[model samples]
Target: MGQGQQEQVATSLAGAVSEEISASLAPVDAELERRYPGDPGTRQPVHTVYVPGDAFAADTIRSWGDQALAALDEHAPNAASFAAVLGLSDELAEPVHSRVRAKLEHEPIEDLRVDFEDGYGPRPDAEEDETAARAARLIAEAFKNGTAAPYMGIRMKCMESAVRDRGIRTLDIFLTGLMEAGPLPDGLVLTLPKVTYPEQVGAMVRLLEAFEKARGLEPGRIGFEIQIETSQSILATDGTATVARMIQAAEGRATGLHYGTFDYSACLGVSAAYQASDHPAADHAKAIMQVAAAGTGVRVSDGSTNVLPVGPTAKVHDAWRLHYGLTRRALARAYYQGWDMHPRHIPTRYAAVFAFYREGFAQAAARLARYANRTGGDVMDEPATAKALSGYLLRGLDCGALDIAEVARLSGLTRADLESFATPRRGDLTASGK
Candidate 1:
């Protein structure tokens, strides 16, 4: 072939390839555009603490915190080590004792999901109602007593018809009993577990709306989290990813999608020994969740480590160590939240999270400040980089890893500058003198 003819053919082939790519990805782009509300990324708790419905009480968390602190003291060498483990400065050594006390006494429960499913399990129908009502009463007492966490909710049974009636009944009874004490607490959510179809989420939204109206609350006053448990929820029979579709079915009310460790792993046929948050199937599900729910602002949480760090007969430092290792793995995967099945896990949870934020804070703060000041640094600061740094700082602030004064001292930027960068915007992020 002639050289000119060959060049023309190559150009035509490139154009065709581009068209094919765009055509194949049109649905993905469209799905992204219309994703439902996920975690706002404004502030998310590091873990969702679940207690059985029949057993939950406001002071239960304080007891857990107390136990956690006691466990740490019983295990950790000294005050310095404790402070160091939590990424606290020397000054904090004195106050962190009281701080830890206050945290336990006040808001130790970050995300509380009173479980009616596996945690509560299938019980006598009356027993289920009684447990649900008891949970409602305790949570309501917490609300009036000002002991509730920032995020509190209930996890109902799967809406798979077999238990759908029972799930809805439990929710209804809980809400009714809760309102009798006072108005609903802030950041309340309903967790619908074992989702298999998009329509189930839509139905839950409608149910919440009706509950609001019946209670004389505003529309959209309630929100929900979908537990990603079954294979069907992740991959539709239609041969497309369906998690986004499930969130969409929420109609702007899905706050997060939580991975159910055992059920999800079981669905994938992972043996009991291999089923874990770090498993490949679990990671794939989370990756799909991240893509479908990223820009949509939905929070993605990894599944729990079934292994608790505590031993019935011993200190079980090795158990705690293994738990910490797994926690670090989850953090490395950018999943800041997981499940703390036991009080001892709480200490390990904060330890891992503190290490993550502290190790990166110096570099992140410098890069972020330099980016904000339009000054060149060792690293080029792009918009996404700025946002990530801002998020890192915000998360640190939320989780108590970094305080305002500490942030100011480290980042060399004002709180206002931090907030400004935190909200994402589209633009060229050219470093000055780059």
Candidate 2:
């Protein structure tokens, strides 16, 4: 009787109802697609080295590499000694130490920014114009000769009333110089510092638009990083999240949001002693930035540590310990990139980065392999987790923290396969993967 009486239960809403709902929400869907396009699936550098515009030269990259190696030779001459200073495990000592040295020799600075802001200070108008033009010419030569950092650019002055026109003039001179030198280098970057309002981001977009038009380049071709220096950059007077608005105002031209440790801390009235990237104030600002940039194809970068690795061996070691610990902490928190101020800081920066990836290499690769192969393990992983794992391995490879052959052997996946997994599909942005 039950079998005869049961009715088919597959009939409910008509097919047109589903279509109608989708039609009604079409604009919302478009907004979602436009606003949250996820990671761009490109190589993000491990650290940005800021050299004053006046100090930057054709041989600056090699000079930094040499200085880093000399520091290593003097302070921690051997792998064992260097490992002891940074408290590396016995297994990681040799590999990490050797990799650090090799990285210094081969590719010391991943991203180099010639500072025209705080680091460069105020220069006479004619002097700055000449320097900006010279910077562009030298950078062009470096790239042509294959001696340039993988990424190179300038950090122009802020949008504040005091320096707005000056910043615009410098950026114009720099980009114009590059255009005259040749088609701009593909690795070119620009930074806008001390953004206090989203309107400033709009201003930057307009500025870039003008440059592109004048140079007969495609629209929206130039992108820049928005530096979060003042407290107003994080929160508005009305308590709204200004950073989120800034990203929207960028109109797809924002490549990154970089924290400015000292300026931000000082803006909040934090004493000089407590001004650091890890300070509570800095954490709050960066956390907001991380959220704001999560699915918007914009990366977040931590600021530099003021502690330089200099002086006697003992003092150098102390500075190394501090820098290493801070770098490791940032990596753990998923802030994959930071600023490296000095050539000597390069050693500890690479050491910490290598050790972080190397220590977790096995687990990440295994999890990714299992997820890729659809074989269950004690820890189950979803597609997003697979993306994260592949991304981790890729970053390791990019920064010399892990090698492709070893990663392939361990994960049973090729570089192409990892790239497929690491690249995000539209409408998903659960992890930064940078």
Candidate 3:
């Protein structure tokens, strides 16, 4: 062929490729529109917190089971909702259930999460696969028994096989068994730990799509929560664009983002000597995640405080309790949904959540009410004033410190007006509420 003919062929191929790329992206764009019709970035307030019971350590698991149940019993009156973590081990399954039943004798249990790793990282050996399968079976059986806990989920291993090898396979087998045995659990949360990039999450989303298809389930049925434990994930050089990509890749399958405090601190060489939870550095990381997840409908949660003393003391315990409360409040103010690693942490969890929301709601209501009364349509004449008032109301709503109705009422504005100004602001409110 002549040079001109060859060049023409190359141009034609390039155009074809471009057309194919556009065709492929069209559905993703349409689906995104369908999933997020109003504002693709507006974050819905996350009111509930899911506490992982650290199912890997037997002693910790048992203790958490007891503490969780006790907390539920003592605080159920004030508790909005609760979730328990169960390790997927045949050996531990019975004990976990027995404890769960015992603890829930007084109060109702709503959710159970089976942690695939028993805590010593993932077991890559073939023998361990058998053991894992057995554990998965046991958990399925327990869920089939129709206990009070309606929500069943699993925290599958992360991408790192050394840390949790049974990542995809375990989920493949467990979900198959659960579906085959009976109805699908109320919800399935695939917790991805040690996530460094959005592509890691996107990969899971693709696998989940395949799994859902193979299992004859609807696409996007399974929900995912990314553990933002690495410094890279939280503080990307591109301003959390990577995190945004990962959330977007989840394609609406992503539900929440969790902070992995100890792991993250370890990654950053932050000393373990000091509690990772509530460390200023950890707070900074959480803030970054909160910003990344803004307007994404994904809830963010802080990592757990690991400083709980084994034994109880009146004053010492109270001090520890206060510390936990402060940590939870900090996370709550950031608009994250869940925390991890301990059940005894529930008291402070509830305290911080209630205090944060209650105070936030009250303040927001007052401010919005004032804004509504003071700024009528007359304010709309001044673009600068309108923007300023809209900005104030939107920030309060975004932080979960205020509600949409209040924002609407205060600004004499519609919900659309408030939502239009929903952009995350830095230093508007400190995590510590100072």
Per-candidate TM-score against the hidden true structure: 0.85, 0.96, 0.61
Residue by residue across 250-299, what tens digits does model 3's lDDT show? Answer: 88887778777778888888877865666788778777767766656676
Flag clash pairs in model 2. none
Q: TM-score of the candidate numbered 1?
A: 0.85
Give the range of the ten consecutive residues with the poorest summed lDDT in model 2: 425-434
Off by over 4 Å in 3: 1-112, 118-120, 124-151, 161-165, 235-240, 315-319, 357-434
lDDT (C-alpha, whole model) for all candidates: 0.79, 0.92, 0.55
Locate the minimum summed-lDDT window of 10 residues in model 3.
78-87
Ranking by lDDT: 2, 1, 3
**Model 3 TM:** 0.61
Show the colliding residue pairs in model 3: 41-295, 42-295, 43-295, 198-246, 300-336, 300-337, 368-410, 371-410, 372-410
Runs of candidate 2 exceeding 4 Å displacement? 1-9, 427-434
Which is the leading candidate under lDDT? 2
Clashes of 1: 5
Tell how far residue 46 is off in model 2, in angstroms.
0.8
